[model samples]
Target chain A: MTRVASMALATAGALLLQGCAGWQSALDPKGPAASELAWLIWFFTGLSALVWVLVMIALVVPLMMRSRAQAEPLAIDAGADGRKLRVVMTAVGLTALILVGLTLLSFFANRTLAAIGSDASLTIRVTGHQWWWEVRYEDATPSRILTTANEIHIPAGEPVRLLLTSTDVIHSFWIPSLSGKLDLIPGHMNVLDLKADKPGVYRGQCAEFCGAQHANMGTFIIAEPRAKFDAWWNDQLQPAAAPTADEAKAGEELFLKRPCVMCHRIGGTPAGGTVAPDLTHLASRQTLAAGTLTMSRGNLAAWIADPQGIKPGSHMPVVELSGDELNAVVAYLEGLK
Target chain B: MRAAVAMLLFPILVLAACQREERDTRPQSALGSGEQPTPVTTLEPGGQRASASDNKAASFEANAFHMSEGKRLFGWFNCSGCHANGGGGMGPALMDEKWIYGSSMESIHATIRDGRPNGMPRFGDKIPDDQIWELAAFVRSLGGNAPSSAAPQRNDDMMVHPSENRLPDAATLGKSP
Candidate 1:
């Protein structure tokens, strides 16, 4: 019986510890704001645990002690009663001090969080849709402003200010390993500043329920060296490379003719539709349908072929196409990188 | 045992009734006969009622799916570019009582099919007839002519005005433009 209980306990312990470290876990913070929040969380949790233990000890100690039987069971000793009152008062005083300490800790933590974004040099406007993020990098030059979806690239050790808003309903922008959750309400803008401590990929998710596919909404922040981040931004500004293969060329023609042209825009082509995400850098993205599936040719074909099947109630409509046309379109999108 | 079975079937029957049937977008001859080559600003010269075929096309005004589809198409086709989400930009304001061509369904259909002089381009060649009817229904709804139950609640775009569902019925406005 002991062996079975120990084995079960060990398994449960292992499972709980697994969540402590991950790309998305708040406990595994990779940025300044998240680290400060993690420290606050740990401090509060430790203090609360200590208080609970002390309470349990106080409750059980008297119960375990054998009290001397009095001649009159209801009679109380005046000296002992006075000692008990003093102990109770001390306990109350300590409780008040702990509560005040916690309040001050949280207050200081918020101030630290507010200061993280004070010297931010970069500004990106992030608009929340039903189940996707529309990231627009702001630049003084109108032509230099770059628009992308789902993925954000930032320079390591540099603070970036995010102007958040929503086009439709209410949603929240939360990157657990970088910062806290901030709501993106329609017609209202909220600003958040964050800086990655090192170069790494951190996953983010919509912390608020917006619509049907809200659970599938995911985003990524890629922190890289300053030079590499600049190179990526410049490359994204270029038009999509024209398809070299005959099959891909045919695919582009079909895409132009179909309803796909009505919602998506591919730079340098006449297929300029602003309602959906820009597909100019389709292959460059790490995932499809707002991270519902990984970026692959098969997943792309499956997504285009049956959008409703993968992400039901999405705005994407299924355009009827033959098997050959599907493959051709997939080939063309793959070459977009 | 029979009572239990009946109780189980009752909810299923109720749920089955809630299922909405999809609209058939295929062109029908019923609407074809009612279509007028020229726009009709008023009822027939003799003050006659609308034709049965005209009523058939107008019935789509009560369908929620049809109205929502029209709303989607309005954006997809860049109608908002000129119309500015029914408040109008270069084009006339659809939400207002003043309709230049006409307010009737058939008149609106004719205007869309054969573009009015100067501004409205001819979409008759590009868009199918069924879609034209849907657009007409949506335009009427924008003017608060549609049944409140069938109108769209809100749009995903930047807030401009009250949604179609919240607008007062056009009849209550008291005068026809």
Candidate 2:
């Protein structure tokens, strides 16, 4: 029975050390922060295993000795003197103290990290609504912040601060591989300072369950090289392009006559409504609708026809138009770039 | 004491049985009764088959294709705001039948590609045609305040122009132009 229990303890400990395999694992390699975290996890996990072994020794050794006592009753009190009791108690007390000390050290490590990295050069304001994160880069020229939903791009090896707030309700901004989560509460600004040592794409999800589509409120951060970052920023600074004379005429006809401008914006065009996402650089982005779909004509047509069918609770009203009209509008939008 | 315990347990059992009965009766009415399930729509995207364009004519056989594409675009670019779960918020709900704009495949397509006035931004050049169509399909599927029986009709006179932005044009505009 003692042997079986010892085997079970060892097995459980081993299993705990080997976590589930997947991209979901925080220990997965992506950035310096995650790699450092993986090492910390392994160190603590190893220490825990050592403590479990000691506990097993205290429990199993006594039972093993007791089983032998049945065979040789004379040896029962031989080594069972108060000395063994003192030794066991001393070992247990010392192990407990070591655990407490290690835990305190970890706590201080986290605190020190938080205190040092709280200041950043660039401040990106993040506002969370029910199911999306509105990211605005505050340092751009013309006092216009480039609005990108969900995905955020930043320069690697730089300290970036996020001033997080919520538009309506509570939300949390979490990018596990880069930094810890920071909550966005209504009427309050919580600042989070994070840095990525390497350039790569890191996944993030809303840690707090804000609403029904909360699970879908996920995003990624792309750490670009300084040059690429600058180029992207430069592109974002450009105003919304003007359509070709022919396409613009078609777009204008479609925009003014088709109820297209009621809930949209075209930067300098008459269709410059702001009820939806700002489309100044709409054609420049790789995806659309808060990262809900790729930027393709078919997907765009389907989305414009019926948004809720794809992403329930979307705000754009489903406008009805004919196939030719849909095609003309698509042509005009495709030319926005 | 035993009698009191029995009294409590008996009522609990009856309530449980009643709940079970309700569950059993629901499927019977939904399946054979031919009753239109007045889908109780919500602002969240998970509830109900909120496809707005599914009810329209010229049924695109690859229906789920556009929706799936839209879902990916939504996650990648993050369009869940204003639209709120794709149903609408500060902006109009996309799932209901009450589209402030027209509700045809073309108008919906144009709206997404170009964006609407009153704050809707254009994606005309930023996104590809294929993706825009799919997103439009997904938006249409939400069945925003449009009537199912009314075929998507064209009304050129009702076309309203989009709003303008304040930024200056980049040199790239001349190249594209």
Candidate 3:
């Protein structure tokens, strides 16, 4: 019986642990803040569970010993009652001490997390749209300030500050693997500081629902070595690559004539529209439509041809493009990287 | 999907954009100049419309509700991001009467449609005509109620004073004209 119960408990524990797996799980943290947070969560869970088990035992012990303990206490000896009260007082004192300790632990953990980003070298401003993120890297020179969408690149081991605000409604920016969520409210800028201990790709999402495509509004944080980060930033500052292939050139012309350029901007080109995401480096992003689909030629074609089919209530207009136009546009965008 | 973004902006834009020639013949006055505008219709460059050319600037530009909607659209389109609530940052300030283009209601709409040579993105295609007019009405209202950006002791971001500076025009500033 003991063996079966232990096996069952082990199986249950394993099943519970599965919830904290995968790319989006907070418990599987990759950054300093997130790792500390995960540790704090585990510490509290263990401590609370231990206390609960003890309380349950205290409740069960009286029932199990009722025949002997209760009957013998019927005589009601004054000295024995004093001893029982002393025991209860000691238990209460222990519980109070434990509670105080846990509180201090949380306080210190927060301090540790806060101290990680004081010397951050990079500053990125993330503005929340209804269903996308407009990311701009701040720079002293006006020409050097690079603007992109959906993807953020930070140097590993160096702190980065993200200034968050909303253009429409309230939204929360959260990267479960890096840090806790911070709200992006209208007319107010909130700052969140983060540092990745190593190079990796971390997925982020909008924790607060802004509108219809709330679930699809996602962003990626790519942490790389300092050298690679600098390279990427320099590359992004360049305009969209010129369409070299014949098919891509035709697609570019069609984009100019069609409604595509009206809402999307391709740097160094005549297509300068601001209401939608800047597609200057569209193909370089990991996902399209704010993580609605993986970045690929097929998905780009599908998104342009019929956006409503992929994400209901999305703001992307369904452009009327023939098969050849679709292929050419896809060819153009795919070569943008 | 286009309608979702343009729902609040349908009728107002066409009132201003479609009628081009009639506006040229009308008397030029500053926005809210209290001079009554001549009633007219318009001819569009493309298939868009000359049908609703019979509306007046007084109706579309002076409506209180449309101005309010335009104020909301200013932030919606991230105009604040570059223009910094119209005092000017990346783009020139709209809070002042100082417009490189004409500051009339129609001229402002034209600028929005055919973006300037600098960084102003063309919003004509994505935004419906009504919303554009609403935005124009709001932008035009800025300096009308606010102090100038050139004021010695100015608090100009909110546009709460009268007569900000408009940049010098070669024709009007004792130049070639």
Candidate 4:
């Protein structure tokens, strides 16, 4: 019985600890805003636990103690009664004080959060679609604004402002390791500021219950050094590399002729439709379908062939293609980077 | 035992009734049986006349799914680029009462199939006849010609104006400026 109890306790502990550290955990904070929020969470949790322990002790100790026998069952002890009233008053006063303290702490935390983006150096507009994120890097020059999807890159140690909005329903952008969740409302923009202290990749997700594929709507933030981030941005500004291979060339022709031209846009190509994610730098992205599947040739073919099977209710329609056409399209897309 | 069997079958029957198949393929009727060209008209001399034979408009315009599909295709085909969600930018406004090409379902179908005089590019070659019909139905809905039940509430994009389903009556709207 002892062994079984210990095993169960160990399993529970492991499960609890598993949530403490991960790329997507609030406790494993890598940015200032997240760290501040994490600290606040820990402080509140610790204080509550302490108060609970004190209350449990107060209740259990009295119950365990032997009560003195009363000489008269109806005898009123004024002195004892006065002491008991004072104790009750003290407990009530303490509870009020703790509540007020917590309120003040929360107010200050919010102030800190509000101040985070006041000095942001760069701004990016992130528009929430049903199950994807359209990331556009805003530049002073119209030609320099770069549009990408599902992934965001930022310079390490620099605060970046994100203008979040939704095209459809409400969605909340949450990269737990970076900052708190902010709702992306239709026709209303919300701003979020975050700064990663070091270079690392953090996973993010749509925290709001948007729709059918909401659970699969994942994103990533890649924080790197300033030089590397700049290089990446510059590279992304260029149009898609022209296909040199015969198979890829054939694939591009097929893509232009097919319904793929109707929704997806590839820079420097005549295929300029804007209803879906821009596929100019499709190969540069790490995952497909807003991180639903890892990026691979096989996965790309499968996704193109049966989008409904993969993402049930996605906007991408399956363009009927022969096996050769599928292979060619995949070849062309794979060379987009 | 009989009651238990009946109870188990009840859910299955209910679920079977819930199944609905959305047709994504082009229908044979959309092809017009080679009797007349499927609403393709042009401003050029001796251009084809708009025909009434290819009237699948009622079937598409009355169905909500087809209207929504048309809405999706409108965006996909970059119709919103020129039409600007039916409010019109480079092209004439679709929400207004005045349609340069007649407002009849066949006329609208012709306008989309063959380009208009000033700027509308011919989409007959690019878009399939079934999708063209859907687009025409959606375009009609923009003008409040479609049934209210068939029109879409809103698109998945930013809300710039009232949705097709919720727009005020076309009679209340002004002529295209």
Candidate 5:
């Protein structure tokens, strides 16, 4: 009985701990934008709670008043009626005053949000797809702009402009630790500005119900120091790494020869398909299939073997392969960093 | 009066929600189970595709209305974003006389369905084959072969608008409520 009780307790603890998974915790602000939003939320919540308490006290006061005070209304005294009228007017005035204060507070908070956007050094155009983020880092020279998917890397402590748009149904881009939610409307653009206070990996999700695979559409923001960020940028600009091993070379060849080449691209190789994420620096990313699995040879092989089983309704197809071929492909992908 | 107007609008709002996802923009008579070329057709063209194919593909005649539908789909699918209404940007220029891949109906269909290397995204998964056929038809017309009546209408939807295609600023934005 003790053993069973301990097992149950362990399970309960694990479940409780799971709630604190900070994939996108609004309370844990990592940026100026999120911090301001957090302040606004707390202020509004506290004020609303105070108002509720006052209302409850008012509701209880009439009941709590002496029996003779209540009977004054039945006796029809003019002074008593005036006093009651004054109390009702005071309540109305308080309600109006609270509302006006909140409205001004919201207006100022909006201005604060807008102010952060004015001085963004870097601009990233994020196009929302059915179930993925197509992120592009812009440069003054069109050719120098870098395009990648799912993962976003930025220099910590610097404001960045995100021009959000969608090609299909509506999707919301939200990085809770970094900024608030912004809708990506088809044929329209909305700009969101954000910055990170410290270097860290912050995860995000599609806040809007886009389609069948909306729940699986995940992205991450990797904020790093300036020099490190520059190195990452330079590395991304270069072509895919050449395979060193014979097995990896064989896998690369197999990838190009099969239907994989029909929908995915690996830079410096003949296999260029833009319909899916670019695999030029696939190994550098932390997760596969937009955070479906951790980046590993085993996970890569599993994804290649049966993507449908892992992320049902995902665009990635089950590329059936012999075990050796699968191993080779995984090696090729793993070597891409 | 407001209540009466709202009552009148309720049914229309419900009906708007009930609108079919599939296209019925074509005429009622045209909505038939006519032989549509297999959505992934590599078969030689019969229709505007062949008329524009020169001698490269099998010929089939098409109507102006059908070609216009194909043109509408081109913009709808964001073909303009890359191809820029067939003048091309990231993808090759469809308006050019020189064809890297063959200028035949079967070849074009194959290219659309089974994407070519070097950034030609496979639309096979996202787009229906029938839509691909229409796109192929519209694209083939870009080489100055489409009948004027069958030509695509210029819509003010491009981000960088041409002088003629530009909308008034008020229209581009929504009118004031």
Candidate 6:
């Protein structure tokens, strides 16, 4: 009873560690990416268990059949139980061959699944900025390639091909629960096709070390139903409207007057520079500064005051701006729906 | 028993032989005394005088050839992290006409060897003198300067000396950022 309890404890400990094995858990067939990988693990694990069980039985059966008195190495004998040994050998050999066959089948299955990519789906061009992702949905009508700052939304169950490129150095696109990462290289377009199996919000971050602020370069994907995506797409198609209120108008004039226009791009407006993240839907995002802080009035105010303090090594130069000007800019950006 | 031992040993021997063959075919660097193609080039193409390989003293090739080494090292050490490929980033662009410090070859060499205070770390001990010069040359080349014709001749110019810090700046470094 004690031995059994200890064995159970050991198994539980190993299982706990295995469960924490972030990317390689067999039980984590939670999405399309992990599910695909799980199939490979299942085949290999099954074969491994079978082989181990057979080997254990072969060793145990020999001991069980013999008496305790005869539990000793026998003198070297050429003539032994030839028939029984031949049967055992043949069984193990066939088991090994089956294991090999299963492995080959799994390998081919993996290759076949990986070969299917971006030919039939809508292509989204994702460019990595200093610490943000510039997502452009190329297939939207008006031929709109809307640059959403960090959070990306897509229609559920539809194949989406991401044409990954980096504006600066190398950065990797990784949405853990959805799919494996594809690197964004400069002067090179690497295409990765992915589809969310279900409608849910999945967290992702930059897997490559681009610079100092690489850690805060997080992004999330909100996979919604087709109807909702269409609605969002329609909203994105509209041109940038003129500021309605007096304060917003003041803010817009200030934004144009300041250095904000030098680095950022706001579509249908005069602020057309490509050095920084596109702020067309800046207020629409759930977070600011490339998902570093929540998009609140206070957070936005703090971000404008000192960007370096919030995210070290970000390219947005910190300039001296009054609290009123900051509020005005934030209000103007917030109205850019 | 002999056959069983042979079978066990056979796979190990085959693996060892394969490893040996791989090792033998590896490309060797020519800057060393042994016969190997130098990764660094000594020739500037436009009929330049060959300088002696006495690396301790300042040679005209140090500016031309070493700048090339610096360029190669820039790629090698992944300097594109901040000072991106001919573009500005968190760090200033090296290719543009903007130089934060003086743009002389010596100043550029100093900037690389001893990193600037505002984030760039000193690469003095990490990289060799020859390679630093090559990097400088590469940075100059990016700024549209013609390759110098007065570089050293022998492949021995490829020596990446760890302590030798006798690299001279280009006659004209581009303007600072």
Highest lDDT against the true fold, candidate: 4
Which lDDT value does model 4 have at A64? Answer: 100
Task: Report the C-alpha lDDT of model 4 over A155-234, residue by residue, as the tens digit.
Answer: 99999999999977899999999999999999998999999998999999999999778998999999999999999999
Candidate 3, residue B125: CA error in Å? 5.7
Per-residue lDDT of candidate 2, residues A163-254 (tens digit):
89986579998777777677999889998777778887777888898865677777778899989998987777676676666755586577
Q: Can you tell me which runs of candidate 6 are displaced by over 4 Å?
A: A1-33, A42-75, A80-99, A111-119, A140-142, B1-177
C-alpha lDDT of residue A90 in model 3: 98
True contacts kept of each: 0.10, 0.00, 0.10, 0.10, 0.00, 0.00
Q: For every model shown, what is its TM-score relative to the native structure?
A: 0.78, 0.57, 0.67, 0.78, 0.66, 0.58
- lDDT values, one for every candidate: 0.84, 0.65, 0.79, 0.85, 0.77, 0.67
Task: State in Å the error of residue A93, model 2.
Answer: 2.8
List of chain B TM-scores, one per candidate: 0.73, 0.45, 0.52, 0.68, 0.52, 0.46
Put the candidates in TM-score order, highest first. Answer: 4, 1, 3, 5, 6, 2
Poorest lDDT segment (10 consecutive residues) of candidate 1 chain B? B25-34
Error of 4 at A23 (Å): 2.9
Top DockQ hit: 4
- Residue A269 displacement (Å), model 3: 1.6
Question: In order, what is each prediction's RMSD in angstroms?
Answer: 7.3, 16.7, 14.1, 6.8, 10.3, 16.4
Model 5: per-residue Cα lDDT over B69-173, one tens digit each: 567666655677888878789878898556776665555665776677787777664454444555666677777566667666555454366564455565556
If the candidates were sorted by their lDDT against the true structure, best first, what order would they fall in? 4, 1, 3, 5, 6, 2
Report the lDDT of model 6 for residue A32: 57
As for candidate 4, its interface RMSD to one decimal place is 4.0
The DockQ-based CAPRI class assigned to model 6 is: incorrect
DockQ of each: 0.15, 0.03, 0.06, 0.17, 0.05, 0.03
**Which of candidates 2 and 5 is the stronger one according to TM-score?**
5
Tell the DockQ for candidate 1: 0.15
Chain B TM-score for candidate 3? 0.52
Tens-digit lDDT track for model 1 on B1-177?
A: 999999999999999999756554434446453355653454676787553237545666667876886787787788988999888899988995568777777777778878898799877644556667778888888999888998876553466856778766888655654
The CA root-mean-square deviation of candidate 6, after full C-alpha superposition on the true structure, stands at 16.4
> Which residues of candidate 3, in runs, are more than 4 Å off?
A68-77, B1-177
